[model samples]
Every structure is written in C-alpha cells, then in structure tokens.
Target: MQSDICTIKVRDCSYIDIEANMAIVINNCFISTNVFRVSPSVASDEQPLLSYSHTHKKWLTGRYIGKLYFEYNGKPHCFEVQPRFGNANILILLEEIFNIKLAHNTSEYKLYDNSDNELLKKIISIIWVKTLSKINIHGLPKHKVEKLNKSSTVRGKIAIKRSVLPIYKEKYVVSKRIEKEVDSTIVAILKKAYIILCKDYSLTESMLSDAVKEVIRVPCYNKKVITTNQFQKIKYGAIYANYKEIVDFSWHIIQHKKQSSMHEMADTMGDALFLDMAEIWEKYLFTILKKCFAPRGWHVYSQQYRIYQNIGFERSIIPDIILEKDGHVVVLDAKYKRMTGHFSDYDRTDFFQLHTYGSYMESHNKKLIGLGLIYPLSERFDKEKLDKNFAKNLYGDSTSNTWFKVDGICLKDSHHQLTEQKDDFLRRVESLLLI
Candidate 1:
C-alpha cells in the first residue's frame, strides 16, 4: 500500500531474521535490527521518492541518522528521513573535516533536513572538491616499463648494453619509466568515479560534469584489483587533507554496483549515498581527544590491538579509542545511537563490550582500565538526563562494579557551549582516571 506521507508507495515485509540483530547503516542512514521489513524503491532516481514502512514504529525509537537498505518483496526498503538530532553539531564536524564552512543554518540546510536529497549532494561536493584539487598535484601518475609499444620511444643510453641482441633494441630497450595516461590507475579510477556519479540522475550532474575535462583524459582501468597499497599511497600523500575520505567515497560508489552486501543498494539504481555513522562518530571523537590530550603528554590510538581470541592471532578485539597515560588507561567506546539513559539491549551489549575491553587491558597491563561510553547529547536525551547507571560490571565482576564505575558520557550537547561540554567530559574523564 502507498504511504500517505509521500508520493512513492511504501510496502512492508518481514525483516530477515539474521539482520534483525544489527542496526545497518548505509548512506548515513540507520535502519534498526528490530524492524520487520521496510519498503524501498529500486529506481530511487526515477521516482525520487523514499519508502515508508509500517514496521519502522517498532525499532525507530530514537534519533539516529543514516539510511539502511534491505530487500523485501524483491524490492528495496528504506526510511525516507532518518532523524539526525545532532545535525547541527555533526554538520560542524563535517565542515571541520572538509576544511570549509557550509551554509548549515541556512535554507539549504533546511532543504536537506526535509528532503534528504541535498545531504548526499553536500557529501559529494566534499569528495569532488577534494579530489579535483589534488589529483594532478603530484604530476600524472607514473609506472615502470620494460617493453616497447607501437609508439614506444627507446632510451638509447640504457638499451646500448642490450643492443647486442637486435630484439632488445626493438622490443625491450624502452625500459625507461615514464608517466603515461595508460599507467595512471588513479586517474582511471577518478574518471570512472566522475562517470558513475554523472549516471546517477538524482545527483546534480553538473557537480561531476564540471570535473570531467580535468580527469577524463586518463585511460580506463582494465584491471579489477584495487590494492590496499594504492589507497595507502594516496592517503599518506601530501595533497588535500580529506583526500583519503574522497578516495574512499569515490571507490565505494564505483564498487557499490558490484557488491550489494545485503545492505547495499542495487547498482542498477545508480545512486550512491553511503556513510558509516559508527565510524564517523569514532573518528570525530578521536580528533577531539587527540587534540585535547596531545599537549598533556598523553597518547591516543584507534583500533588498539589489545586482545586476540587465539594464540595464532586469528580473531581480535580492537576497540575504537584508547587513551594511554603514565598511571591510567581509559577505554572510550563511541556509540552513534542517541540515548536517554534508558539502556536498551544494544546499549547493554556496548557496555559489556567496553567491560570486556577493560578486563583485557587490566589483565595485559596489570592495571584497572577506566571505561567510558560516549553518546550524542541531543535535545531528546538532554531532557531525560535521568540519573541512570546501566552496568554494574555486567561481566560478573560484582565487587568493583559500584565503586569503580564505567562512566557514560554524553557529548555534542545543544544546551551547552562546545567548550563547556568538553570541560564537563574532561572532568568526568579525570574522575575515571583516579580509579
């Protein structure tokens, strides 16, 4: 049945049993694991409308941003607008990451909030700008060559040694390395990205069209393998600050059609809007903690490999953020979901995970690690600052649960100044450090 809210028809389906446990995040939208099923349109570009689900009521309890893609009734299912309560703060963070201030408090922001269209546009703008500005700064990409092509120029100097063999001069003499169009995989990937974005009719094609002439000259990529080393080279390169983000976003969209991963939108749909809300929150926290703690002779690390399941190192438990100091170790877990102090099953799981991390850190270093959970301090949660304690060491550690608490910290509060929030958080963190 068509939902009354929008032009597109909304359908309901039984949410797959396996996916029922995970809050799938895609395109910066979150779909709850508890939802039975949602209705999504395949050709979002053609309809330019979002799906409405009857079952979203069950799991859509709080303000969580990011779209979730699911297949039901042989069609895609999604929520049109995922509530982003901390939009103001998140926009500020993204702006900082992009190194540019966008019109957040303006009408464009309103349009994005209401329509969910310009949100992706803003994301792509970051990618396009960062990509074009740095793509050629290092000069056209180069590759080593040992064979001669039809138009190959032989390096007479190097070829002189092999000139004794006639074929060496004709076939292998032009062994000199050169920067050519065909060898530049980066350019090929960039060109493909431009074309892929252009194909997605929903997006403002002009955004990519503007970049076509600059990157279109590179030859198409004939190889399928996208190596880890290639991305690392671009990431560590001295180019745009957000170049890695741009490259990652570009590659995901380019590869989206190829790998749907159940949560992925159909490549035939052609539009790509994906953001891992969880990762974003973690990274944002890392920046804040790293900046504040760096001057104080503290070290902050992400995915600190502190635990492994087996001696062979086959399984691992790498927490998002870890703070190491002379006397104290703090494990900060960043959960993207909005909370009101009423811990849900998911929140409990997070608490246990943080507890496990603490346990591991303590056993490894012979020191009790301070645990902290940081949730978004939105207006909804701000009202219900109900004095709540979620876990008293849910990991069977009853003796120390009460005295040594796992502090639950909320950040990005609209009610308080950013500095004030940081001060409050730091205070809480200090108390944890004492124990």
Candidate 2:
C-alpha cells in the first residue's frame, strides 16, 4: 500500500469553533490556532483529537505526520499528511528516516528517487513491478501438495484426515503443506497488497494494471494474517531477494488499520494516512547511536526508565538514549527540532531534563555520567556558534570530563551534501563522548 498526503487550506482562518465529535492530530510544530485545527460536522468518534483555538492565518509548518478528518467552509475533508520539516522537503526526510530505520538496501531503492511526483502512486508502481519481476524470475508455481485428485505424483506419505481412509486407500492423502500453496501467507500478503494498490487513484504504472489483472487469478483471499514474524521471512523467498524493502514498505502501509472498521483498508486516497516524524527522528537516531556505539564497545539502551522523583503516586522518567562503557555512562534526550539561532526556554528545559537524568543515573549506578542534547543541525544556525553553543552554558563539566554537552549533529556539512552526513555525524559523536 502506498501513502498519500493531503493538501488543504483552512479557508476561514479568522474565526472557527469546535465540538467534541470531530478530531485532528497536528504535530507539536504546527500552530494551535483555530484555523489549523478544524472540526467536522459529523460526529465520528474515531477521528484524531485536537484542541481548538481562534487565531490569524499563516503558513502551515509541522513535520509531525498523522491523519486528520475535519470540515472547512461547510464541506467535510480527510487527509494523510507528511508536513515539511522547516525549509526541507518531507519526502527527502522520509527517505533518510526509512533508510536509517531499515538499514538495508533493496533493488527497488530507486523508487524513492523521484520526489517531484506522487509518492504513494510511485511506490505502488514500484511494488507491483518488483513483485512481478520476482514472480517471473522464480515462476508462480508454489509447491502446493495435495492429498486427492491422483493427478500428480505423491510427494508425501499417504496421510488422511478422517477414519474413512480405508475406503480411499488408493488416494494418497498428502496432508503435508509445503511452500507452494497459493493460500500461503506470502500469497495472502500479495493479494492484500494488490487490493490496497487498486484502491489508490490515478495510477500511472502500466505494470500495476497487469498486476491487478493477475491478482484476481491468484487462488487466495486477503486473510489479514500477515504478522511481524511472517513479514520478516516473506522477503527471503528465492525471488523476493531484491524486492525486500518494497514489500516491507507495503507492510508498513497495511498496518494502519481503521479504528472504526476492521475490514477497511488504510485510507490512502483521501481519508487516512500519516506517520509521526518526531517520534521517527528520535527512534532512528537511537538506532544510529546503537549501531555506532556498539562497534566501539559501548552498550546502548533506549527509553531507560529511572526514578527522577517519587511522590505518593510513584511517577518515573525515561531517557531516550543511554550509553555505557566500562565505568562511564552517557545520557541523551533526542529532540527532532531546529535550533532557534539562540537559546530559549526550550533549551533551558531540555538542559534541566538532562541534568536530572545525569544525577539519577550517577547516584544509583555510581558511574561518571554525561548528559547531551541530540538535535538535528539546520540552516538557521551559525555552525561555529551552534557547535560551541554550550561553551558558556551551565551544562558541561570539563573538571570531571562528564556533564552537559550539545551534540550539534550536522545533518549536512558545509558542502551541503547528505551522502557523507551519517559517517561524519558518528565520528563527531565519538569525539564528543570519548573526549
């Protein structure tokens, strides 16, 4: 299944009101004004919730991805969105996110190359093409074993289901199910993918048409049995080797089930689609930190919980990234936000959070702990100043060589190229921690 992002205008930005029925999910970056948060006339309990406010019209800015259902100027609307991250394009960010997340390159990697077109349609086309190519190379005949018909040579022992085997002794009851069954989980995924792609509008992929035609002939139904473990093995089939990411991405789209309807497909066309880019950045950075640190004999743990404070209610806190090697520990909180050119309350709050984490980890574990803010480098900041933005700051302990430090992770270097960004970031991080 491909994802579609909806574009909309709040039409009446000056004034608006809301009721309890309609809902919307906007990234924290997006404005909380009444125009930005709209509500629908119909009462749909399943809509994503949002707070309403009346404010002036302005450009929409938010990298958080999620679905929204609302009404503007008397008409209802539905959208699946991936909003831009600052001046950066959303699709490119998606490419970076997924590449880092999957950490594997498939033959269909080129599917993400074209950014000027519809992402969902192109992805659907690529999936169809890649799947058909694999099917052609390996042939569609799955090794389906049968117990009756006496049409093919026996591949299994004469196994029967009921006690009436005596009468049908001549018929070898092949109870063994091998890989060739059309109803196998892989084929079920394919059928489901086909239906999902079919529901998309304005598909230009010619192969998609052929794929849909042949999909109807597949002797299987969309059983909705695709599981996490089942998905991991689907790509290992002889033909799917190069098609791994495409199929895996398709699985991602399929997972977004409608809360209201079990049988309904993901809202790719107009109604439903979205992803949390904020959560994604935090998660992906954690993954990168894990991989980069592991090779250096550092152990990384994500969402490590500790008792920051304990009232009668027994509340706890979780840090996004925690790394330990020998007797040294690094506590980090990932922020998927751009720098404000100078420090603000946000930075102060973040520093306080990290300080709290360092104290908690050090006191209990009795190890030298350092705190860091991991943030993406954007075009708005002076790299030199931003790099040393923590120099005069309260966070940093050169005396003990462990305290608060600013990561200033450059997503792109002076050359403005992203290709070398990952390695450069890791090296910088290593230097920052090992120092």
Candidate 3:
C-alpha cells in the first residue's frame, strides 16, 4: 500500500497516529466519519461509527467501507475501508444494489493496490447509467430559460434598457425571449462529466448502452462554468431524485480529476464516500425477501420503527426487516457478522435484542408469528452445522412453534463466484421465517 493511503476492513482497526495526523480531526477531537455529517453529527450510543485507541495507536473502524480523504502538512492521505470477505462480494453487493453489472477484472485481486479509483469509477458510472435511464423515461427536464437576441424585427419583449442605448439607435432591436429548453446547470455538468468519464476513465458506450448515451447526445453546455458550489446546489424535483445524485457523482468526478492534476488544488478536508456494509446486507435481504414473498401478498419493510415506553420515558426500537401477510407478522434482523456454526459462536446481545423486539411485537400486534436472525452463508461455514446449532440454541422451545429461528443466505458458492444458490437460500429463509 502507498504511504499516503491506508486500507483496512470493516469493523477492523488500523494504526494511525491521531496526534501526528491532524487533518482527520474535523473538530478539536472528533474525527468525521460520514460525508453528510461533516460538522456536527456525532455517533449515537447505539451506533459508535468510529473510535481511536490512543494507547494502542490504532483507529478502530465501524461497519463502513469506501475511501476517505484527508489532507495534512501539505500532503493528501486516504483512509480506505474494505470488506472482510474481499472484493468479489463487495462488487456483487454493489451490482445488486445498483441493478447494474460492474465488470470485474482479475488483475484487481492478484495484487492489492492503494487506489480504489477503479471501484469508485465503476460506482460513478453505475449511478450515471441509472440516472440516464431515468432521464430517458422522464425525458430531459425542461426549464424556462431566457435568451437575449438581436433582431431586426421585434421579438417577445424588447429590452428597453439595451434598445435605448446609443449603439442600437438604427441597428437591430435587442429582445429577451423566454423559451422552455432541455438545458440547465445540472445537465451541463452531467454532459461535461460524461465526456470526462468516457475519455479519461474508460466509461464506454457499450457499458452505458447506445440508447442511454443518446439521452445526453447534444451537449447542454450553455458556456457557463459550473463550480463545485453550483454543483452542490443543483436542484431537482423530489420525484426525480436521481438528478441530484448524478450531479453529486459528477462533482466528485470533477473534483477527483482536478485533485489528481499535479496537486493543483489546495490541501483541504473533504467528505468521504462510504457505504455501510451491514446496511447493504439488510437491504439486500429485504429486497430478496420482498421479491420472493411478493406473489404471496407479503409486504416487506426495512428499518421499521416501534416505540417502547415505560413510566415517563420512551425509547424507539428499529428492526432490520419486517414482513406482514394477511394477519401474520414476522420480524427479522439481518446480521453481517462472521459465523462458524458453533454453539458458543453466537452473540448474547443479539439474542437479547431480538427478544426485546419480539416481546414488543408480540404484545402490540398479537398476530406476531415469528422472530429470527439471518446471517450470510460463506464458504467458511457449514449450513448443516449452523442449523443444528440453531436448533440446539432453542433448547426447550417446542419444535412445532415457529416463534423464533435462525437462518443463512448463501451469498457465495464453493468456488467463491457470484451466488447461484439464491433459490435455495430463499427457500430456507421462507421456511424459517414463515409458518
């Protein structure tokens, strides 16, 4: 790894001298871990995003993976978090989430490198593709734009101030024409970004498809130089949410390119691009279960919140996944932890947490039929052993009772390729979560 770039896995730790590296500190003591919460958002008690051990001279990572950039002493530094299971699984996760294929290169795994630029670029391209696809569906958003044109005949409205000028006495009349056009700062930036990405980052028409590229065929540059500030403030309807996302990615691409150009920009603190792996796992499970259970009229919800109040105080508890079909309700928490199918390998905290969640649901919903935990099935773990251990954990519970269970999703095949056993995994999950 490069001296300037340090890489670690999610939920792992790294050695970074906090006293030596002052740039990581957004404030006096606290280091900013999230991109959005650059200033004031501190970690909640339940989710300790990041921490440092001064005595150990190490920075402990939370459940986040991506690249964070920091600058100190006129030098740029990067703190990267990767998945413990390696690049393939992370790629699969991204592909599934984005609903796009990110072609994998074998060279990436042969030797680890400092720059995660390739992965970052793939993500940017995928975002671009998604945005372009939406644009194709919604058509380019039209905006009312005013243009000043000089004509012999009067136009929409004569510019009184300009028409009265001495230079325009017997010449052409200056008029402002307000016309609706498929052009804006957002479109301009994305157009420029498309060119930059394709020319410099190997983003191809083949990757984005000819149809997607046709959406931005005509360059929308209105000769306006879009700054980072303008890019950040690009506005769009809440209905077309991808517009803002595309603009954000474009800005990142532009800034990254500028920063790579011989360090022309000043050393400054910037936001990091990261994804919560555990959240991704939860979302993946929710999406899969929703698809699998949709025909049966089951509704799947992610991060459903419930209030628990005692005496005068109230607390909120959120479960990862909840399913409702007819009058039956099932709550499940997706865990991205390492499991070895051993009886003692389970965490007691998870059991207690699920117990609280189940108890709340049982009391409130009366139709609550099940509660469960789901873990990823890796090549390192045995599914039969996991089932046996899970059954053993349920010691005195009746076999017929479907109140609680533990299950696994086969996320990888034996060869560690993309998952081909999703049907099997979904079947197991259905059997465990539903009676």
Candidate 4:
C-alpha cells in the first residue's frame, strides 16, 4: 500500500504538493497565490541553478541579480544578489522585517551585501551550537558522558574562582615594604644635603632665618606666609651670592695685571668666580637636599655633625654626612672621583668604617636603619652586591642586618645648574635625596 500522505501546516494553512520545487510547496498553501513567483529571482546571464538531490538543497539561482531579502528565524536579513549586468532588488519577506539601505556606489554589484546576515549567523551559531551545551546540569546519571560534562563544569568553576581570589596579595605586601625602604632612604639623603649646605655657607640657626623665610614661600610649603620665588631670592642674595663674591675676590688677588683696571678685572672675576663657586657640592646638594626633605620632616647634617661611638674600635669613622629623621639614621659618604672604578680597598675599608657607625647605633640603643654611599654623578655602584658584602663583612652573614642597607646616589652636573638658583638647587636636592 502506498504510504499515507503527510501534510505540513504553516500558519493557519495546510499544503500538499508533490512538486520537485520546494518553493512551490511552501507558497502553494502558505501564500495562497498561484500566479506569484515566490522563488528568489535571478538574471538571464547568471549560472544554472545547481541542486543536491539527497540533501534537498537549492543551489544559487543563476548568478543572483540585485539585492535579495529573506527572513530567517524571526528577523529579516539581506544579501546583495546581482548578475554580471543588472539592477539590484532588495528582498524582504518576513514579518517585522528590518530594512537596509545601500548606497548606489557600493563596489560589490554581483553579490547581495550579506555582512549583516553573516554577523547574525555568527552570533546565533555561537550561542546555540557552541555555548548552549555548557549550561550546568544539576543532577544526572553516572554515565561517562555525564561524568565528563561534570568534570568540565568543575574545571570552569575552579578557573572562575581563582580569577576572583587573592593571588597578588603577597606582591602588594612586598611593594609596600619596598616603598617604605625608599622613603626612609630619601629622608636620610636629604638630611645629609642640609648639613652640606649649612657648613658650606657657614649658616647658623640665626643665619638660616632669611633662608627659612625663603623656604617657607615655596609652593610645596603651601603657606601664604612665603612664596618659593621670594625665599629663593633671599637665599641667593645672602648665601650663594656672598660665596660668589668671596670666590671673585680670591681670583682677582691671583690674576693681577697692569693693562686691565683691577676694578674691571674684579667685575669679570666676580662672574667667573660665581660660576666656579656654584659648581661646589656643598652649595648645590645642600640646597636641593633642604627643599626635598624639609617638607617631609627630614633633617640633613654634613661635616661637623658628630656621632660619638665606642664599638670596641678606637677611632671614629666620621661619615661625610648623616641624614636623620624621626630617629632613623642614613650615613652618607661623598667621594670626588672621575671614574666609578676607583672603589678601592680603601673605599671598601671606609664602607666597613661606616658599618661601624651602624653597629655603634645598634649597640648604643639608637634607631639606625640604613647607610648610604653618595658619589659624584658619574659614579655608579652595584648597591645590592655592596649591601650584601657590607652585611657579610660587618655582621658575618649576607642577610644578618636585613634592615641595615647601603645605597648610592649620583650628584652630576646638577651642582653647576642648581647653584645659580636657590630654588632649583633645593628641587634637585630633593630629587637626589629620594632613596
């Protein structure tokens, strides 16, 4: 017996067509119009329609002509379907279909622009075909497929959990520790810069009144009582300018000549001398150190500052300067050398000497945290290895004095540039003092 004919219903209509054309089957009932050609249009110059018999798939209708509009799922999508020679028509069939308007000058005249269709297809494919199966199944039989699915689910959950948890807490802790160390180092360097300035300028506490007045005026001070520019003027007029005068006077005494008037020579000498005196370390570094550290409550001391000690060693190894703030000490020794290679056994010995200062502080109940070795700008030293060696030589272990450290700072051409302006010097000093 022949199989019972099955009828397919669309919308409110039923259709039965044995015709080979799928379009005829679709349109004969749903569309209710026999005269209309419901199949997609093609052009005379287009290729013949190719078909797969087994899969019942229709091939391109000739080379498509004009634009083709169709509905897929619930949305209207368009493709540019054009023959080698013809006007394009947009096809729109679905209810609530979206319209697309293309410019006449579009380059692809043969193919209907299906970019939007492709984009929708990709999104739908990913959602339905790719990701849908990944949804969690709360309960399942203990079959292999179920077990494998559960394992995948657990792995994804663990990954999400790790992503949200505390992997970097230790890194943050280390960073904070390093920052504190840097701050402490800066405080020490600034203290030393201040001492250098005071000694070089022969500045007493009373002498510092004018400098203080100028210092308070700086913008960083943030006080209406003084401006940085005004304070700089006072400091320049008092300390740095006077040093310039002394240098000029000394130069004039050395270069006496009959042709040039001594007064004229003195005037020329004064400019040169000022330039020369400004190049001095004590003048520039101290000013910079003061400006850099004073705002942070760091005190710099140079030269005459004394740290008396008896660490079973008879003689005191007085450092060039000591930077101190809130009871923390940073011993800084300045070296005037051309090449950084001059770190001799003597220099190493001197470092050991400074380590003695640290030992003294530890023994005598003082809060000595670190030591700094300051050199001219061109000099470079390996601070890590130096610190390691220092700890080993002095404390008998590479890490014994973990808190006690050594660092190097370079004061290059900043002295010459900074000495001319008190404020500039202070700014540079502040930067140099940074640990």
Clashes of each: 13, 4, 0, 25
Best of the candidates, lDDT: 3
Candidate achieving higher TM-score, 1 or 2: 1
In candidate 1, which residue ranges exceed 4 Å CA deviation?
1-78, 86-89, 96-100, 103-118, 125-128, 131-156, 167-183, 201-245, 260-274, 304-314, 326-328, 343-346, 379-435
Which digits, one per residue and each the tens of the lDDT, describe model 3 over residues 1-435?
A: 235544333332223444434524422222223322110111222233355655555655555566656554556556566655666676676566555555565332222333444454555565566656654566565667889888777778988888776335677778898997775776787777787778655466656655566656756756677876776665566555555545665665665555454342223433344555666677667767887898788888755454745636666688777788776777788887655565644768998898787677667764767777887755533566645545422234665354566676656623244455656667766765544
Give Cα-based local distance difference scores for all models.
0.48, 0.48, 0.59, 0.31
Model 2, residue 24: distance off in Å is 9.3
TM-score of each: 0.62, 0.57, 0.62, 0.28
Q: In angstroms, give how far residue 378 of model 1 lies from its true place.
A: 2.9
What does the lDDT come to for candidate 1?
Answer: 0.48
- Best-to-worst order by TM-score is 3, 1, 2, 4
lDDT of 4 by residue, 326-412 (tens): 676655554332224434313566557767766765675656656544433333345444444343223554554323334333332
Instruction: State the lDDT at 184 in candidate 1.
Output: 50
List the candidate 3 regions with Cα displacement exceeding 4 Å. Answer: 1-61, 67-80, 105-118, 141-208, 215-272, 306-312, 343-345, 380-383, 389-400, 413-418, 433-435
